[model samples]
Target chain A: MHFNNEELGQLEDRYRAKLINSLSGFKSANLIGTTDGKGNHNLAIVSSVFHIGANPPLVGMIMRPHTVTRDTLENILELGEYTINQVNADIWKQSHQTSARYEQLVSEFTEAGLTPEWLDGVKAPFVAESRLKYSLLLRESQTLEINGTVLVIGEINNVLVEDDVIANDGYIDIEALETVAVSGLDSYHVTNRLGRLSYAKPDKKPDVID
Target chain B: MHFNNEELGQLEDRYRAKLINSLSGFKSANLIGTTDGKGNHNLAIVSSVFHIGANPPLVGMIMRPHTVTRDTLENILELGEYTINQVNADIWKQSHQTSARYEQLVSEFTEAGLTPEWLDGVKAPFVAESRLKYSLLLRESQTLEINGTVLVIGEINNVLVEDDVIANDGYIDIEALETVAVSGLDSYHVTNRLGRLSYAKPDKKPDVID
Candidate 1:
């Protein structure tokens, strides 16, 4: 099936959204944890987290239009700090529940039956059940005028992880952590390692590592 | 374990890069296909594709600093179009090979053992071995001065998919298509659907859809 621009535009609005959303395939699943000035916690499931740079340890997330009233965006902007917790199979349901549109005063942590724990000095809370998590200090944010969306980039401040999850090479063992992958808007997935290939070289075939 | 910002900065370079890369979890795996004005083909494996908006069907990809000389970025900018093909189990090894540094005039499609197919009126070619592919028209390019990276936004102009891969509600069945997910730089993954939940609501629990 081939859908050209005209045909794609003709698709029913909802259907086109679904098709486009899932077209990119599996996305990172993380719960963005934040707290308002009064220390009320908020958690939202985000799939757009992508590495921006390694030296500065920066990560970027795309927030939808500001017209949507995003609490996570608000908290990150106001508090200048937050935490990103990898969502694993053990708590995917609770993580998904965080997407619900509760009132301004409500905390998704409490509403979704997930516990929030703060690092001694970090302002934001981490999802207590998450095995791998990191607190981030807001670095820079730029609103994309083309679509009215904001790209929030954050600098890593602290990382908290279970001892066994980190490999000797610094590769986080995500499969072993059971961190879920997401597709479309509502689907969650569990991933099995197919293989890890050696760094590519022009003259040599890649060797798959154990 | 907790690694503060200062400690993260002091870690070994490769270790820090790997740790920061894996922090984001699974990313969308695709072969970015492009054609130069001279009709030369290019394919490169990319994991940065992320959904930006569905109204105009926009997708964004982060291109490393152009100082490194990226062929896909060059071709997309010169030709004004490109294709994104979902990487799957059948071609994961070939796809990973696309990451190797070939000569300036080399076609990774041939070097990586993948077939390139053309669609009418689309300048760029899609990966013939891929079950899901989409071509896009260059809409915008913005350089992030903070890190010297470029964010390339494209409007999805056309999509070619396997007949049965699209569901009734317009969701692309990535699992059925065998689309693979990627972690860090070289790890490949096969996914199993855990489940899909209903649209979230504040007062009601999300009903898990079978």
Candidate 2:
């Protein structure tokens, strides 16, 4: 529809909830600690994590702005690292709560009622419950002033998916992931894997025009 | 299905092909450009725009490494201003092709056979073909070293939707907008308005729960 700034002010929050609850139907994830450096350790549930490119294996994420202090922003700026920890339905609520304002000393893992683990070299924490925790290094971070959010780009250094999550050739099963997407705020959803379209190899014949 | 990095490495190209080619239906968009200083004119297509937050209305995009000189990045770095032009199915191809490495002096609108417009006080050129466009300012820019990509973040300042495409309360109809989407490489798709959802208001249920 249409909205003036004052009317559309809730756009981000609305979209966030829609994305999490409606569009995303497979899994949720947590924004963990910094990667290569010791910046900050923060936690929040994000339904947005999709690749932008494959040659370089690039991934994109939407980091909503902080109403208060943003630990993830501070940490990533200082340490230059982050881990995207895949969240199943079980930990979605707990992970989502990490959005709460907490002191630097407080760990979201404790507050979220979850455990934060570590990989040998990466600085970002891993959700102990995750079957696939990607230890990615922050290659770039940008803030879009229009939306008052931060888009963090990460180069994957290590993918710590449990053996069970993959097929022989790296195919990931949506069912196994059991990931949920957030639609509106607390609403959650799971989607059917509509057969994947073969984008790389165009599959249709050119239609004849009259 | 599951895949290991090693396996993903072998089939990465194939999956990429499928992934990109599969983008036959989705919301396609263009990133209008402006100088960070005095608002130099720039226009480029962007399928990478993504939200990073709700409260701040943050969004981000992955810019291919500077191998190709991009005025948009320059503007974002220099003046920190940009606009996202949402492309419909009608102009999706033209918008997508703006990624071709063209001369810095060459106007993409001219090269691609499109018109560039301006709005608000921003100097960036907008795609006349877009159904909706949002003017924004660069809040931050982070270069991703791991993937050799740059992430640009922008906050939305003003949004412009073609009168016909918007609903009364700020709903932008995708089906009506005829928005398209993109994938890995050469892929294009028009999106359908699957449904709508509302944000979490604490006092109310999300609009999309049904």
Candidate 3:
């Protein structure tokens, strides 16, 4: 099938959303946990998280315009802290439930039946069910001029991971933790490893790394 | 295991890259195809692509600083057009090979042994072997101040997908197309889907859709 810009723009609203969302291919399933500085906690499932850089250990996630409820973004702005919890197979359903539009005072941790654990120095809460998670300090937030979406960049403050998942060379075996991937808007998937390839060099084809 | 910011900063550079990259969870594997508007074509595998919005069908990708050979970013800026091809099992090795720092003027397509296919009205070439792909026109480019990385935003110009892979509701069954996901920096994966869940509502738990 071929869809030009006009054809794509003519698609029904929800249909276009699903098609365009899935067009980006598989996405990381993660819950962004934040607190309003008081006691209200917020958790929202986001697939927009992407690694920005490694030296400063930066990460970026896209948030829809604040035209509607944007508790997670607002909390991060208010406190400059948030937690990104990997949504594993065991907690994918609960993580998805966090997307519901609960009132500002209502905590998604309670509404979604997930436990929120607070670590020392980090103001935000982490999902206790998540095997891999990290705390981040807000570094920058910029709104794209073309669209109203906000780009939230954060620097990693700390990382908490299950011991067994880390390989000797520092690669986290996410498949071992059953970290799920999201496709489209609501479909969840568990990944099967297809061997790691050696670093590419122009002189030779990459071989499978042991 | 827990790693605070200081400890994380002290780790070896390559190890930290692997750890920090993996921290974002699973990433989509896509080949960015671009041309310098001359004869030189460039292809590179990128896992940083993320959906920005649906109404305008915007997609964002992070490009590392131009300290090294950044043919993809340069070509996009020069021509304002590019193609994103979903990396599949059949061509993942070839896609990975494109990351090698091939000198300017050498086409990765020729080096990696994949065919570059052009369609009507789209200047960039799509991977002939890729079952799903799309063309994009550069909409905006911004250099992130926190990190030297550049955020490249593009508007979808067109999409080409395998006919059978799209469902009635506009969800593209990427698993059916054998689309692969990347982990850390080198590992590739194929996914096994859990059922799609219905949209969340505050009143009730979400049920599996279809």
Candidate 4:
């Protein structure tokens, strides 16, 4: 099937939204954890998290413009800190529930029956249930004029993970962590390792690690 | 284990890179196809692709700084068009091979053994083996001064997918398409659908869709 811009634009609003959303395929599923000055914590399931760079350990996420009240974005901008917690199979249901529009006073962690724990002195709370979690300090943000969406970039400030999940080479075995990948807005998935290959080289045929 | 900023900054370079890279969990793996004015096609596998918005149907990808001469980025900037093809389990090895630093004259499709099929007067070619592919017209480009990485944003111009893979609501069943997700830099993963939940509501308990 082929859908040109004309056909895509003609799709019903919700239909087109889903088509465009899921068309990109599986994305990293993480719960963005934030807290306001008053210690009001917010959690939202997001699929847009991607690596910006590794030297400063930066990650980037996208937020839709005025689509809904983005408490997570507001909190991050206010405090300049937030946490990214990988959603695993065990906590995916509760994680997805965080997407619900709750009153400003209500914390998604409390409403969804998930535990939020503060790491060291970090103001933002981390999902205690998540096996792999990291804290990031706001570094830069840019608004895309083409659309109302804002691109938020952050630098990793702290990280907490189970010791076994980290490979000697520094690769975290996400499958070992049982972290979920999301499609569109609602689907949750578990991934199986399909084999990790060696660094590609022009003359060498890539070798797959067992 | 807790890793603070000082600790993370002190780790071995390669180890830190892998740790930070894989921390985000599974990322959408796609082969970006582009062609220069001279009509030479280029393909490079990328995992930074993320949705910016669905209205104009924009997608954003991140390219590292001074990273080994990015031909795909150059081709898109030069011609203002490109295609994103999902990398599935069947072609993941070939897809990973595309990451090799090939000479500018070497086409990844030819070197990696994937077929590039030009579609409907579109300047860029689509991967013949990919079940889901889309062509995009450049909409915006911005360089993140924080890290010198470029954020390339494009609007969806054309999309092609297998017929049965799309659900009634417009969500593409990526698992049905056998799309593989990438972790860190070299790991490929196959995902299994856990469940698709309904839109969360403040009052209503979300239900799992059949």
Number of the top DockQ candidate: 3
lDDT for each residue of candidate 2 in A86-116, tens digit (9 for 90 to 100): 6565655565566566666666667767777
The deviation in Å at residue B197 for candidate 3 is 0.7
Which of 2 and 4 is ahead in DockQ? 4
**Highest lDDT among the candidates is held by which one?**
3
* Best-first order by DockQ: 3, 4, 1, 2
lDDT-superior candidate, 1 or 3 = 3
Q: Note the DockQ of each predicted structure.
A: 0.85, 0.10, 0.89, 0.87
RMSD of 2: 8.2
Clash pairs detected, candidate 3: none
Question: All candidates' lDDT scores?
Answer: 0.89, 0.53, 0.91, 0.89
lDDT measured at residue B37 in model 3 versus the true structure, 0 to 100: 86
Residue-by-residue lDDT tens digits, candidate 3, B81-101 = 999999999998999999888
* DockQ of candidate 1 relative to the true structure: 0.85
Cα lDDT of model 4 by residue, A1-210, tens digit: 999889988999888888899877789999999999896889988889999889989999998656444888889889999999999999988988898889987999998889998877788999999999999999987777888788899999999999888888999898999999998868889988889999899877789974
Instruction: Please write out the lDDT profile of model 2 over residues B141-161, one tens digit for every residue.
Output: 766666666777666666666
TM-score for each candidate, following the candidate numbering: 0.98, 0.56, 0.98, 0.98
**Candidate 3 lDDT, tens digit per residue, A95-199?**
888888788899889999999998999999999999999999999998888988899999998999998888889999999999999999999999998889998
Model 3 regions lying over 4 Å from their true place: A67-69, B67-69
lDDT of 4 by residue, B28-124 (tens): 9999999886968889899899987888899999986466438888898999999999999999999888988998878988999999998876999
